[model samples]
Target: MNPLHVDLGVTGSVLDVVRAPAGVLSTPSPPVDPTAPEVVQLAADLVATMRVSPGCVGLAAPQVGVAAQVFCVDVSAHPKTRTSHGTFVLCNAEVVEASRNERAREGCMSVPDLTGDVKRATRLVVRGRVPLTGAEVTVTTDAFEARALQHEIDHCAGLLFLDRVAGAHALHQRQTYL
Candidate 1:
């Protein structure tokens, strides 16, 4: 164990992603105990699912049918990423600070069919506990990493990109998958 990070045992098997129209996807998720065995398993599942989901850079516990405040994100491979941190899983994440707003097209694994224009902070400082170690860590990041973090954090709060779209006109059906 890294002392500051819990060994959540990352797996590669894909888990079925829960879609919209499911009540859980829209309901607020409760915080999980950082050290709980179930939470540890969830952290693993989240990473696995995100790895297998196409065009996915992030995922939330609620997206997987678990109403818990946990999310996994990896923007390192994304071409748009400017400050990559590889992959990170955070439990009960809080956006302690945010600045510099920018508008961009956003999509979610849970809302796979629809994409929308959303305004998000270009820089962010997030605080959360490492589930396995119960270690509190703060991340300061910008660009694509920051956007991914905000999107996943929104999932923890039961909000989706759809809710953040500028207008109904801002929403669009995704035309490309690549």
Candidate 2:
């Protein structure tokens, strides 16, 4: 079964996105019960927020001021995307496998002014639970979808692209938003 094709079965309201330097963004989020009512709602909320935000492919619970290991991702429409899993939410996600590190520019809604060159795995396998069903699933992907998954996972771990940059020289001022 395609784990990415999830039906949250609940309406979600868009929540305010928290900015960088906010304690929640820096503080590690705790693993959540995937099937719990609140976790399911939070998963839906993350998806809703990501959809409403232009150029956003993923969103984590911490970005919405929730300190929980939950996130949603969708990269189907991105020009850089090679393999997409569509939209999906996961709880307690972790990278089970990764390889082929490549440096690429990354931006965050939490830190709107800067983009950083961070090395991330181009191929990845992530393991996590589906939010509504608590079904454990493994996602194997490459290219932009892999990068998007890693970015959201980092947010769950209290790290930003800034934390992954090689140095200040690798950072660039954002002139425009995609």
Give lDDT tens digits, candidate 1, residues 1-178. Answer: 3333455765545678888878887888998998898888888888888887777899899998889999888898898989976777899999999999999999887887789999999999999988788789888899999999999999889898998998999999988746
* Candidate lDDT values, in order: 0.86, 0.93
- The model with the greatest TM-score is 2
Estimated TM-score per prediction? 0.93, 0.97
Question: What is candidate 2's lDDT per residue for 21-75, written digit by digit as tens?
Answer: 9999998999999999999899888888999999999999999999999999999
Model 2 off-target regions past 4 Å? none
Candidate 1 — which residues are off by over 4 angstroms?
1-6, 10-13
- Candidate 2: lDDT of 173? 94
Error of 2 at 6 (Å): 1.7
User: RMSD of each candidate?
Assistant: 1.9, 1.2
Q: Which pairs of residues have clashing backbones in candidate 1?
A: none
